[model samples]
Target: MALKLLSALDAAKIQLYHFKAIIIAGMGLFTDAYDLFCIPPIMKLIGRIYYLDHHNSDKCSVMPKETQYKTTPTAVVSTLVSIALLGTAVGQLVFGRLGDRAGRRRVYGLSLGMMVLSSLACGFSICKTRNCVLVSLGFFRFLLGVGIRGDYPLSATIMSEFANKKTRGAFIAAVFSMQGLGILASSIVTMVVCRIFAVSSNEPKSETPDEADLAWRVILMMGAVPAALTYYWRMMMPETARYTALVEQNVVQAAIDMKKVLDVPMSEIAEDSPIRLKPPVLPHPSYPLLSKRFLRRHGVDLFCCAATWFLVDVVFYSSNLLQSQIYHRFIKDNNDVNGYKLAFKVARFQAILAISSTIPGYWVTVYFIDRIGRVKIQMLGFLFMALVYFAIGIPYKYY
Candidate 1:
């Protein structure tokens, strides 16, 4: 009664290939998070290095004199941080449909390649003036964002199609959990690199031009490492059997591919028999996404998902990208600290925060998602987040 590919995939037992697929798809998500979130801790340092005056260190009455050091305007910093989101918005639209049309495996490696190349290019961004440097960095990061955003739909679709029904949710959750690890890795790597530069220098609080510039570059470029490592494996991966059978309508090829991936013999698949291939007695009309029937069926669900995701991301990205600014207010006010050293401190703090809260929350979700059910967990998460935000807001003035 069911399609050969779907039946095979649903019936297959958990095996090595399942785990391999998770890794292959998950690494892209890992790189995505690392590259996206890595900018926060370093944003202040970027401002200090390029926008602020290096020569002045005068103390101020209300706040640190470093306010005077700012040569780069706040708008420029906001632009550098937000430009990637613009790129991602465009990429999601372009790549989402492209994957379905062009084939997932074919476009998968391209996204990874873009991420690797753009990460490196972002690190190496250079120009004569600060404005030019910012412009170059923004362009590369926009490309990087394009690459990272492509991974979202591709990986989710690939994982979902390839996964067995029994453990499909878990498998997809496992893939997404890698994003938390990626975030943690970015912080840890930045902390280590900053520490190395911090200890090597004789003058800890004084900015060394070479080290300050190199540190941010290294942090940005480190994102490319995981993406590059996974590229070969991703290219070798076969297209999902669902896409092969349903989308491409090649039953035999789909069976063969599933055999290789699932490690099951072709003889085991009774679903592929000729009788099962007979046309349905009554075929349903295929409706476009905006058609009345489609809208009636899925409109509310789609709107809720889109709205919820937008709200969550608005909070998540804003909090993450502006974390350094938040922490800076509480930290010791010192104008003497070099940009690199300050960046190091911020990176370490963020790393601790990620390790303590962010990474653990992800693993918990991965383990409990199937058991607790997604809707319930999501509701609970939203509730907790709301409560936390309310508490913070109520006490905002005290800080």
Candidate 2:
């Protein structure tokens, strides 16, 4: 079996296959971000639908002079919004290990399937009682979160495996940048649905509750479309050469896969035919992460990277939690809306933020990450984040 797999990967030129890999992984990220962020714009509609104050005269009203509407309890709102995150944590841990043991390609499709099915389930969770709907929505969303989180490690691992050393970071960053597009798409989808269902701003807010009801479900299920579309390509993708050769120790199969991936002749990839070898070469020894040998070899790197990532994600998701609050505070002092107006406003705001910040931020990382090198770019990112935090009087410690 072939021994020159790593060298071949290192030496290969960028090809259509590489870009296709990027798109496949990027679509997963797109689905992940869409599912994660879609809840915020539609929260008010959820409240209007489920948290109505029946005794109030203007209960869930859609009049021209509509003044206020009931909001769900803060704790209930918090639970509904954050349950997906809890599911994601569990999914990441479970799927991360499973991807290693069972196989990346196999686990990849399962995670995506989980996303598609759970999204539809969340949408289909219409119920006669509020409690019934909340319970079903929360549970299905948790499952959706589990599926959404798997996109990260799987996409990153697959992209890294497919990329050459020189362009690896850029490829992975490109995958991540797709999240920006997903977020923007979520906002745009909300806007379009609301426009279709909602009356004009100058008109009475008397559009039937059924319209808003149908709107949120449509938004939630839209995630399933892209995710389901991506799954076919994801399953069509070959298992990575690195995993097959290095983990499974099937060097001959890895060679053939690489030949297809690299779209090069076997002779050009390696000196001899892989089948001519009597038996596969054993994979290099790997260390258990908890072992002393492994720690000594990788401890500092692991700690630094993990800590850095933890801090970033903490800030990132914290912002997500705070985003709705921030918008409501600035836009309307958290005033409740009896119609779809608030959702439409929030959607517009989200689209604006995507255009001004999120899209540019991710695309900049994609374009500059390789040229600048990872560590330096990371340092710059931290510097910018720190400056923003400091300006806002939030204390942060760098790892």
Q: Pick the candidate with the highest lDDT.
A: 2
Q: Write the per-residue lDDT of candidate 1 for residues 265-315, one digit (tens) a residue.
A: 677654635643432344345987779989899999999999998998998
What TM-score fits each model?
Answer: 0.89, 0.89
Residue runs of model 1 more than 4 Å from their true location after superposition: 53-72, 202-204, 270-285, 330-333
RMSD, model 2, all Cα superposed? 4.3
For model 1, give the RMSD to the true fold. 4.1
Cα RMSDs, all models? 4.1, 4.3
- Per-candidate clashes come to 3, 1
